[model samples]
Target: DESIDIPYFGELNGIQLVNPIWVKAVPYNVKVVGANNNVVTHLRLWSTEPSKKQLVQDEKYLKMVSKISESLYPDDSTDEGKILRLQQQYLFSSAGIQDAIREHKALGRDIKDLPKYYTFQINDTHPTLIIPELMRILMDEEYMGYDEAWSIVTQVAAYTNHTILAEALEKWNIELFKRLLPRIYQIVEEMDRRFRLFLKGKNLSQDKINHMALIGSHDVRMAHICIYGSFSVNGVAALHTNILKEIELNDFYQIYPEKFNNKTNGVTHRRWLMHINPELVNILDKTVKGNWRKDLSAIKELENFKDDESIQKEIKNMKLAKKRQLIDVIYKDTGVKLDENAIFDIQIKRLHEYKRQSLNIFHVIYLYLRLKKDANFRKTFHPQNFIFGAKAAPSYIMAKYIIEIINRAAQIINNDPETKDLLKVVFVQNYNVTYAEYLFPAADLSEQISTASKEASGTGNMKFMVNGAITIGTMDGANVEIVEYAGIENEIIFGLSAEEVTQAYKANSYNPRKIFDNDKRIQDVFKFIKSLDKDEHYFDFVFNNLLNVDYFFVLADFDAYVEAQSRANKLYQDEKTWWRMSIMNIANAGFFSSDRTIKQYNEEIWHLDTIKL
Candidate 1:
């Protein structure tokens, strides 16, 4: 389809617009059968080939796209790879903006009104090329003046900051920008020159001026470009927003205080609760009045049944049934037999040093040592199954080593007859949303133990809470907000606050070696980990990093985390008390709903209206 008629609000009857051909959007489930005929599924996005004829009406564009597409991308860090990435960014942004302009013209509207009809929310710096691309189109192609183009672009654009990690922030070399996108580069240069002059005119200090520069040290900061070009800028959480203003983007905040705001990230309660836990939904429907599905806040009524023995018994039953489902899943997928009655303590997320799966494994090693050292202790200790699910980036060496250590530890522990029934470890393969549906509803403890001030806002934290899992976390990211909502008593929170962590970094005071040396239990765990039959060379990096780097303060906070885990375990022995706390977690989780987050974005930032279905 070359063009299609869309119902556009106008004095005219019909507006012909470029037709977007919707292709296959389903996820491809590739089943890999092993030697034993056991099957494992790998889910990936379905890909489509570019249509040579349909991509452009002009033969020149078709040839241009084809030629650029043929270029090799070596690695993300290489200069050549960066250049290729910019070329791809320009291709996508230019096409999308051009289509919007073409559609606006088709509706018999002026380009000045583009802001009224269209809004582009750039999720991150990936699509930042759209800023200069839009400016170039208006000035060169549309023959509009620079000031006019700039005004419309700013009016229709917004940016959201997802991560505060320095390495994650995107920057481009000035030479690369000039070579690949000359016209867009010229517009960017102009914007940078104007931004510098604006800061100078305000009588800012030399240091502050340099910090605010769009182009600094021969690199074009994409984040600065985004902040300058967009009408609104926000962080994913309240704490993250404050960090942006107080430190990360302080100069930008000084200039545009109104632009700096917070819209904490949220998870879709529909899939997390309604679809994942239908039995719990049925229980909620019976206990609570009004439509809780449409408006999650109505679920607060569950707090009334928090202490009801019958409701608590039903909650335990629901958890048991979900655990049985997970047991079957683990057996079929990984061939790991699990005790359905054992505590399903889980940590499922992207494997990263900051997220700290290594810390979780270290605690598992500590528990294993305790069981092995004393027979009387092993008999009295509660049975626990530590379940982990994550995939490390291919390039993250330390993270990959952590995954290997987990798997090897699982093999050693599960094979030991003395510990097989008392304590078990299982690392689920190929963790995805499908697996999450089976695991979250069964979780007795949710591991959200990220380093303080590193995690922006974890949507996983909210998902676990909504599904009735008690969070054992530090005061980081949305965990602080979670405790506030669920009540501090309900969650097992430990370690430093964001302020304390920042102060420690400033003073260079944290010493992982001291913690490792002073604690006797830590020594025993380290010895046990060493004695495990594994290749020393493979995990040398993990040992060196923890002993030396300890960048995420894993060792520093180990004792507090262990203590919190003990507290949670002790409560678990009293089934009624634990289920009461679990109910509170669910009842207080309504505020973290995506419905509420979207409404906040609509009202505070986007200013769009809701259309009733």
Candidate 2:
């Protein structure tokens, strides 16, 4: 009966398959439908029969459909086929609203009680249509009028903003919206017109009108709908939320300051730290002598014992044991064996240009060339094993080439006797979630040197920090916050400050070529890249082609990074100091846990408390 109420019955049934746990599915060995001919559809259902005076007077079935539909898609959906999908979204949302109203009535819940029991959390713009959908349910079906339903509807809805990137922002075509949702379009036009009229007598300018208009052009900006419809609108970070208030959605913020808030992102730390490293978790639980699970802040208490040589050795040995487990997996996957004794430097993430695995390679190539070129520079250090695991989004060309270059470089360096002892570079394939658990805890160092302002908030940075590895990262993204939380002496702080980076961009200047010319070490690194004249050449392109275009400010930060890396290599010799830094990093990282972030959100932003599990 509930599925029957949905405008798109088939679509709701599919949603039920994934979402509704009670709906057990029967096996279908048929393979009947042709893949190309068939497509999905969304259903929208309404009581077609005219509402008699008695039906209008009885306020029962009216609000149920409205409430359910609004709850289902309080915002709107954004995908490729805007017209087809918008109709599909509306069908399901409308039926959902209908179902909610019916259930509430059945339970003898009054209109006032609906607000208490029904709280709608609109995830992005995909569900934004719930606004007008509720209005239709209220006014048309129940004869309650528009204004009365909106007040109650807005109170129950909350919105979360996921991305500030313009590409991610959604806008529906005006013609398609009107064609598919004529009644909703009528309400939107009336609302927008009234809004325009509200400001007509005031000193509001054309700029304000252009920015605020809902259905003016094809762009039915979903974020705008989200902000205007809901009582609460939140960004996913302190800095990102600040970006929402101060920059991206400033016009909306100015109109309704109280509505805007920040809820910084949080990972479920249980999966990230505790469950991931059972050996360390067991040690912490046994030695530290308390449950630090809920009160994650209590992990800081472990710092005092970190300096205790016996505990430190035990932790270091546990990391090596994890390394052995990871080595088997790595050898199985990539057919490359690694020594558990060497510096297991790991950089694993999505292969974006901004993340700059190319810079990492350049540094590797630089080290390999120096070992071979410098006659006096004998093998004075433990051989460094550079491990990279990344995947290029099937579309990215340069990223794929970067992968190829790293793989080829590995083959060349791993075989050459002169360079093999000092450095070995390897790119592990198909880096995913399962591999990440093994990769993080085994690392001697975690590379997080993305170009500043490029990475929004790297969850990977926090993972590396709490995993008892020293971070050799730039002062960017969460790395800035990580350095602040960990202290500068505990972690390497290289590259330009946020301010310097901004100023350089503001000046309309930042030359990659100049850095390559002036810095001798940088100059030598590029020269060695060009000097590879082997018949089995790894890189198929000129060295200039690789560094000159320099996608992620690689050449720009080359010297500072090299100098910082030298400091890192030198510090690695003092095992005691390196281990101490690693220990302090893990201890201080308790503050960075998602638990703390969520607590701050409850007190300051959400104004709600957990039921204390």
Error of 2 at 201 (Å): 8.0
For residue 449, model 1's alpha carbon misses the true position, in angstroms, by 0.4
Instruction: Write down the lDDT of every candidate, Cα atoms only.
Output: 0.80, 0.68
Task: Give model 1's TM-score versus the native structure.
Answer: 0.87
- Clashes per candidate (backbone, < 3 Å): 0, 24
Residue 517 C-alpha lDDT in model 2: 73
Best by TM-score: 1
**Residue lDDT tens for model 2, 58-117:** 343344333333332232233323444564466555655666777788998876456666
Instruction: Provide the TM-score for each candidate, comma-separated.
Output: 0.87, 0.75
Q: RMSD of model 2, in Å?
A: 10.4
Best by lDDT: 1
